[model samples]
Target: MRAVTYDSYASDNSRLKVGRVPDPKVGPGQVLIEVRAAGVNPVDWKVMTGGLDGMMDAMFPVIPGWDVAGVVRGRGPDTPDFVDGDEVMSYARKDVVGAGTFAQYVAVAADDVARKPASLDWNQAGGLPLVGMTAQRSLDRLEVGQGDVLLIHAASGGVGSLGVQIARDRGARVIGTASEENHEFLRGLGAEPVAYGDGLVERVRELAPDGVTAVADFVGGQLDTTLAVLAEGGRHVSVADNTVDQHGGHWIWVRPSGAKLAELAAMADRGALTVEVAGTYPLEKVGEAFDASRTGHTRGKLVITP
Candidate 1:
């Protein structure tokens, strides 16, 4: 199988190469997928650069990706929930960094796989898992619900965009922070848009004068802004900053859950959720895909058509 692999960590992406590699082994309770598409995320590049090395173990010649959507080709022992030809998706982050989705085939634990949303095509499904799960986990931690006014930092980015939609579906009023260019895009996702950077607190306050009932920080370094606009008893969570925990807010690192992924699929099918694929690259051009993600300007997800 042809897959992307990196032998060492470096600031440059030169280490990422597409080449023939042995097929992944299907462990017990795992399913083998003939990958159709994979999502490129910031963590893909960050892992390659050793940003997460101290926290997560890595195997050499590492294949680096976690978001995948494809058809099940085989099943490991004791896996009875799916069979050949099932269309599925997974946020397949392993305990270690390897056996990733940026390949023609990937072996993912059955517990991490969920049926793909019938309403989404391959590209959208591939891009939805990681971002959807991260956003869902953040919202769940904050207990966003009806009567809440949620303030989302970087709400036009991949995870933030999904977070906005999910919060809206929960009957919350959303105020999303984005650049001036993305304010309208955030508005289209059912969020009141406020430009980020200086005076973000004031802008969000203007939108929710009584105070935001919850805050989801997708981009880091907004602890001050979160503290300023959050209601006295409101909840807050951040995926980007651990310091949030010290400030009485929860810090989230999303876990893979088939049940949660299924819920997101249901939302998608019901037209209450949608995923945007900003660009798609072939497997051979995965470095370019990574570069695009690193730009941090894409309005939505970047995908690799593997």
Candidate 2:
């Protein structure tokens, strides 16, 4: 199998390399996927740059990706639910530093994956797992529901974009903040689009007279203003900078959840959810893919196809 790996840790994507790697073998209860597409996330770069070195599981020469969508080519004994030829997508648990769907073939634990939405192609499914699950868990943690209003920071971003659509589908009034360039797209996704910058709090308040019941801030690092927008007893979840404290709600780091992915996949299958792709690159160009993901300006997701 062809794969991309990093020899050193730096924020630089130049360090990534493409090479031939032996196919992975499934463990007693693992499944081997014929990877058609892989989702690129912010953490992919963090892993390459050794940003997660403090985590005891960090391993060098890692394959830095979690979101994977593809066909099931083989299954190991003890894994009974899925069969060969099944299409599945997932954000495989990161208990080990790097072992996921970035190559032509990947071995993932059976408990970590779910059937892909039949409505989405390999390209779209590739980008769904991580961001989609992040959005779902945030809303679930916050108890976001009908009749509530939501203010999403970076609503045009990966998780935020899906979160906005999900909240809208659940009958919640949604307001989103993005750059002026992405305002129209956000509005089309069923949110009142507001430009993010100075005086963002005032602008959101103007749009939501009663106040926003929840705030999911994907863009992190000192979000006092974002926390201020949350209504009393509202949920405040941060996918980035999880250590940051807040006034009212708890912080959350998106964990791998097959059940959540199942729910999200079902939504996509029903056309109640959609995956947007900003760009795609060959696995050999994983360096370039990661570069694009770090820009913080991708219209949606950056992906790598095998």
Q: Which stretches of candidate 2 lie over 4 Å from their true place?
A: none
At residue 146, candidate 1 shows an lDDT of 94
lDDT of 1 at 289: 85
215-301, model 1: which lDDT tens digit per residue? 999989999989989889989999999999999999999999888999999999999999988999988888888888888888999
Q: Candidates' lDDT values, in order? A: 0.92, 0.82
- TM-score of every model? 0.98, 0.95
Per-residue C-alpha lDDT of model 2 across residues 251-277, encoded as one tens digit per residue? 777788677789988888777889889
How many clashes does each candidate structure show, in the order listed?
0, 0
At residue 291, give the lDDT of candidate 2: 72
Candidate 2 residue pairs in clash (backbone atoms < 3 Å) = none
So what's the TM-score on candidate 2? 0.95
Best TM-score goes to which candidate? 1
* Cα misplacement distance, residue 247 of candidate 2 (Å): 2.7
